[model samples]
Target: MNREILVENLIEFLPILYKKFFKGLDVCEITKQQFELLYCVGQWDEKPMTYYCSKMLVSKSNLSIIADRLIEEGFLERNTLPEDRRVILLRLSEKGRGFLCDQTNKFKKEIINKLEKFDENDIKRLNEIMQEAREIVTKLD
Candidate 1:
């Protein structure tokens, strides 16, 4: 199979690892969608709604709906910049942060455990390939 197909398959499974491995307690279970979105937005301490829409390749209206749901669930908050009240910014809530910390730790452990099976050369090649992919994506953007 081509490398892109392999990457696509891996992308599909990354989110499932959270539900199947990182079990959340009570009503806090992170839906695959929520986890994916939070994974992107959490990178920015605070970011505009437009930023998320563009980054996730979703329509603005769709992003707005998801953002609203996240805010209602206490996972994220919508705030307006003092200088730009017309636009909104997204930030994760305390709940979101706590959840992400656990998720990140679980994700790291799982990933490292798998990667550790590979020799150092394989790990180095993976990093190099990933960096090349990032550079290609940057140019495309």
Candidate 2:
């Protein structure tokens, strides 16, 4: 198969795959964008609003609105830096962590159940192909 065609296929299907994977599974009722924010914020102990803006490739104004909504939804909390009160940091609340963990477990169970139908050789081949794809993707990063 042509590499360009393969890349185009991935580009077209990746969003579909993501939507299928995550749809109807957000027990906390957060939007996909909000869930992404929660996931990024939860990856670290805490991060400044600006840091998230850059990491998420969103503007400060946009991030502020998303952050505000997550805060209202009890998925995130904002705090001021002790040394610099002007700097605001975002962190996942207890509810946020619980939701993330729950979603992760759900995904794990679903994936495992789906994979169990395949034989060991098929699983190994899938893993090898996925690893190759991962390496290609990492080059873009």
Candidate 3:
């Protein structure tokens, strides 16, 4: 396999896919970065701040700034681990979960609209392909 071509295609395809399906969707009042943070927390609830910094490839200070805004907005909660008071953990509040659900629904609807031209068979095949792709990609981690 041509690994260079595969890398180049992924680099080009990912942004295009994101732009078509996720970019510019209504995220209530939060910035895109804030929404992404919320999504990450929603997916990995009750994780330490360091986890987010590592997963998102952001600095601790930058993650703190984003977390602070989300906390003030009532979408996230910060807590200290009972066993380790110095470790700060983040989780989504009820409001954050609801907001994330709503945003996800909106994104799904947009993607559905874009896929309307595809026949049922094509859609099914696409779903299968995507699942296979996901399984293959997860090996990178």
TM-scores vs. true structure, each candidate: 0.73, 0.76, 0.90
Error of 1 at 33 (Å): 2.4
Candidate 2: pairs in clash? none
Best by lDDT: 3
Candidate 2 — which residues are off by over 4 angstroms?
A: 1-7
* Per-residue C-alpha lDDT of model 2 across residues 42-139, encoded as one tens digit per residue: 78658888998877899999999999999998989999999999889999999999998887788788778766888999989979988998998888
**lDDT per model vs. reference:** 0.78, 0.84, 0.91
State the lDDT of candidate 3 residue by residue for 41-110, as single tens digits: 9889999999988888899999999999999999999999999999999999999999999988888888
Please report the candidate that would top TM-score against the real structure.
3
Off by over 4 Å in 1: 1-28
What's the true lDDT of residue 123 in model 1? 82
RMSD in angstroms, all models?
5.0, 2.9, 1.6
Q: How do the candidates rank by lDDT, highest first?
A: 3, 2, 1
- Model 1 scores what on Cα lDDT? 0.78
Arranged by TM-score, best first: 3, 2, 1
In model 3, what are the clashing residue pairs, if there are any?
none
